[model samples]
Target: MKKVFIILLFVAVSAFAANPDDLIGEKFIDVYGKDEKGKIVKLSDVAGKGKPVVVVYWAIGDVDTYKVLPEINKIGKKYKDKIILIAPLLSVSDDKEVKEAKKLLHFDFPVWLAGSDSIKAYSIEKVDVPYILFIDKDGTIRNIMVTARDLKKIEENIKNLIK
Candidate 1:
């Protein structure tokens, strides 16, 4: 039993140390979204210099998730031209409910509809509703915020990257 416990702890620690920064500088998956003008936009085009993007893959009914929109926008404002908000509004649960949630965000940022493959490529499996990913200008996902408590730390990390 003691040996088993020791192995379990080692596994947990290893998993925790699985390099949170692993996704940086990777080629982006071809994620797609419709522009406000009803045109499809792909993630490839968003990759550019002088900009680090925040990609939020959020579902509709997640009430707490929606609250972060404004705060994310604040970060966007801080970096100004250096920040891109690519929040893909998905109907992962309530298809009809996302529109209102989208409206509530009042975001001037580009909102897209992510396909299942894109979601999976970014590891969007958890039921946390509003999981956020941060990608630098080179299209590498620098970090994934596992909880809302991680937001401030995520912002600070982005600020450092932007500079």
Candidate 2:
């Protein structure tokens, strides 16, 4: 029983230490998923490269997700030359739905099919829609927002980070 407990404790500790949040200051996990075009897209491909990236995790048909898109769209256009915006719709595994969402949302940014693997890689907990992460040009996550209540603040941060 003592040996079994020690093994279980070691396993639990390793899992806990592997949480994706640990990648925040280090590097953004290169999650590969399909885009609206059904092409495999990697997060690292869109991030870094002397531009800050804003990644928003949303769900299709969620009102809150729809609500946040306009602001994100505006920001994307305003920072078109300096920053990159990406929206990864959660729980959406089909290319057809991704294409439909791209048209419906009229997003300026790319919409990706964020699968279960992406979710686990982000270490997302029971969070609300429009979970946003601001990654620096160096591919490090600088800010994270679980809610969209403070749009002005986030936009300011984005502008500052991109500069």
Candidate RMSDs in order: 5.1, 3.6
| Best-fitting candidate, scored by lDDT | 2
Residue 86, candidate 2: alpha-carbon lDDT: 86
Query: Per-candidate TM vs. native?
Result: 0.71, 0.79
- How displaced is residue 131 in candidate 2, in Å? 1.1
The regions of model 2 sitting more than 4 angstroms off are 1-23
Each model's lDDT: 0.66, 0.78
Clashing pairs in 2: none
* Total clashes in model 2, counting residue pairs 3 or more apart in sequence or in different chains: 0
Q: Which stretches of candidate 1 lie over 4 Å from their true place?
A: 1-25, 92-99
Kindly report which residue pairs in candidate 1 clash with one another: 25-140
Model 1 score (lDDT):
0.66
Q: What's the C-alpha lDDT at position 31 in model 1?
A: 74
